[model samples]
Target: MAVSSSLSSIHISPRTPKTPRAERLEDGEEDVELELLGEDERYRATQDLDGTDGQAMEAATSKQPISAKDKRSMVLLCVLYLIQGVPLGLALGSVPFLLKEHLSYSQLATFALSSYPYSLKLLWSPIVDSVFFKSVGRRKSWIVPMQFIVGTLMLYISLNVQKLLDDPGNNVGELTFIFTLLVSLSATQDIAVDGWALTLLSQDCLSYASTCQTIGLNTGFFASFTVFLAFNSEAFAAKWGVPHLTLSAYLRFWSIVCYAVTLWLLFFKKEDKEPATEADMSIKGVYKTIWTICKLKHVQLLIVMHLFAKVGFAANDAATSLKMVEKGFKREDLAIAVLIDFPFQIIGGWLAARWSRGDRPLRPWIYAFWPRLGFGLVATLIVYWFPKPPISMGFFAFLVFHTVLSSFASTVQFVGISAFHTRVSDPLIGGTYMTLLNTFTNMGGTWPKWFILKGVDLFSVATCKVSDAGVDIAVKAAECVSDHGKALCKDINGTCVTETDGYYVVSALCMVFGVIFLVAYIIPTARKLQALPTSAWRVKMS
Candidate 1:
């Protein structure tokens, strides 16, 4: 859910002009020249040319200053992006922490499915891009309806969530289904906003769109994660002399905010009409382009790498915080740790960008890979030795330090790979190229999580100790972990006692796999890929 800022920085090339000239390449080779126009400039050029030359039009637009309308558009974009982040933050950050208290790791794994919709949204993005009602507005046709639906869904969940979570039936499947829908809608909104951003701002100030996305999305996520968790905690609320907010109340507040924003967008904000000269690719063409890109040998190799690269960190990323919570670490403390690490993530990204410059953009990523993996191992140790509740200030500080270090390394790797993505992505289809690579990268992190979580329960050894009418008896821990099993165990007055936690076992296995992956694939493949000329990454469109 925490996307790299580099994604927003993609350079989408303008449509190729009908007339072409020759230009010299850096290698002293001559090639046909393609002029790049910003989205706004392109739109203006298509309207009432009046014999104005392309260069003159470009110069005029370049000198045009930002207006009040443009500033309003920027603010609108930030709010839209912020709304998009809400469902994602709830699904990925807050819900998991809340569920871990009552649900088994396997159930939590099921809930993890909610986050996959965002990752797989790439599959449907072309459809969202290609189809829209022109009268209403290309972006608004999707954004308004999707956001409205998101608000409605949030309202529905706000009313029913408490009952669902507290139900003895263990409604994780229902929760997953509903949250999946919510997140899917959010992804749809993201697609629309991403497109709308192109024309919403002046050509000269277009780069600010990415800045808005980064700021808006991170702020929204922080509100939902750190602020929500802190306020939702009884101890934290009591300590601060504030009201303890429930998840339901939090969702309701956001739902109303979503409604307010969506209403404003529906009636107040008008999307700029797309130029008639600009033709969107048909959905079929979009799919064909993706297929063509996929067929390239370089792309194939990169996709394969993205699919498996995160396997090493799956256990640590997915289970470490939950394991710490299971060991009695308070959610408030966890939230605080995240709060402190937030700034470091930004700093790490900036540093990674600085380090990733030049020909080998992937060098920093390759360098950080091992340390990041080691941090995963270290996280497991931290969780293993996590002290009892009412933890000392010194130990809490260490935990914060570990989180900052791990997050810093992860951010470096993320930004470095994203920088490489920027370097190789074809400007003509920058959004699609970047989305394809990002989707694969997100999947690599997502798919292995459920298995890793399930592995914890699989490798764990626990037993139910029961005193049946004064006679001692033992039952399988699995028989006591489920909702029904817990009730059955309670009927017999039994307590589930964990002998060997699966966290340690799973973490160890992940460490071993990390080493294997690093030595066998990541190092060699990254080096080879980075050394390849940029030409290898470009696909020739038919």
Candidate 2:
């Protein structure tokens, strides 16, 4: 059967008669009519060869009916993705602020190097596909061991966090090593889980995979980022009987959770293994499959789009948290902003799925692009006007508006793009191909941060002066102007003093790329691409 993404494209029927333009104006529904291509015509568009008529019909016969087993499969996949999210949440959301008290902005970015392992995971995906223990299961063999190591590492960190906190300078190297190791293990486990999903879910149920990922990931992020931080706060800790909540305690809690989940997976879950083909059983075959995917014309275009799609707002996202902190936004304030953003994100995903269902699977991308660009500019302004005085009710109103608008637009765009990738990736190499798309997306968001950090280092300045009594205090460059005009304070009073301009420039770059891709590539090509049936991506393994 044709392996289509659950969030598949709209099948426009060619038989619909053309109508006047007036039909589109009724109730905001689109009225344009076009010839709907048959599934065979769509499938042929993605094929490189002729004469597979009998095989194509045979392929269509593989569709299976849903039963209780299918429902259990979906639930297991959701749990697997959720488990993948916890450590990821801890790494990206919590680690920055947790280390903020000691690390400078530059140091924080430097240490955040650990998080980039996820972006590079495609490099080792072939190995993940090629090797496994026969006793447990191919995917489970990797998943269980990786999770065990990850849990052990978290517990190890919990035990020694006090020594590290006491002497951050001496212990930072160790902390970075441990954190990087933790992130690496979590990323590897992701490979196993993703591969398992491909094997477990039926084609009809595959589209919901991205939805499951978004929900589970966001939930885990809220828990690790917001809830854990709250638990570690002085107010909560004291109220809960601990006067001082050490990092060890916070980590230990998660360590126990990880261990419990590991046990659950080992005993409670059963993997019904499928026999591996010759290519799947060998490393050479894995690379050959990867090579074949890269050579596909549509897949090649997708790689480029995935790389540049998010470039417009990358720096803004990376700098927002630190910029907020510099503007006196507390940890709780950042957490609250994310809390407001989360549900809107999930709603956006649901909306995208609904909108993509019938005649225009790519419609969300077109509709969401303009808002994303507008809000990208709006977010830049919010960052530009950092540390505004009095922190008024109106200020928070703007914050809420910005967060909600941006989150909605971004989530919609993400859902469309993720579904598009899934729709086009060959199922034989599903895990590896999907990882490649995600790796590119992650890299698009990452490379810009390096430049943003470099600009911050070059342009922004921070200084502390020590008094005779041995008290040291931070001094804003604007404050030093009266005492040190021209000689030291030139261009230091406002706008030019902070890295806000860097954000503006980056946001503009993203908008330029967005327009280029939308107008030049995405809009013109979307209709033709969507016309191709989901079967266009399927191939017999070599």
**Best candidate, TM-score:** 1
Estimate TM-scores for all models: 0.80, 0.77
Candidate 1 residue pairs that clash: none
- The most accurate candidate by lDDT is 1
For model 2, name the residue pairs that clash: 1-59, 6-207, 7-207, 12-36, 13-36, 14-35, 14-36, 312-510
Cα lDDT of model 1 by residue, 402-444, tens digit: 8888877777777678667655554445445556777787788
RMSD of each: 7.3, 9.6
Going through the candidates in the order shown, the clash numbers are: 0, 8
Give the range where candidate 2 is weakest over 10 consecutive residues by summed lDDT. Answer: 1-10
lDDT of each: 0.71, 0.60
Off by over 4 Å in 2: 1-70, 166-172, 235-246, 275-280, 357-360, 387-390, 461-501, 525-529
Q: Give the TM-score of candidate 1.
A: 0.80
Q: What is the TM-score of candidate 2?
A: 0.77
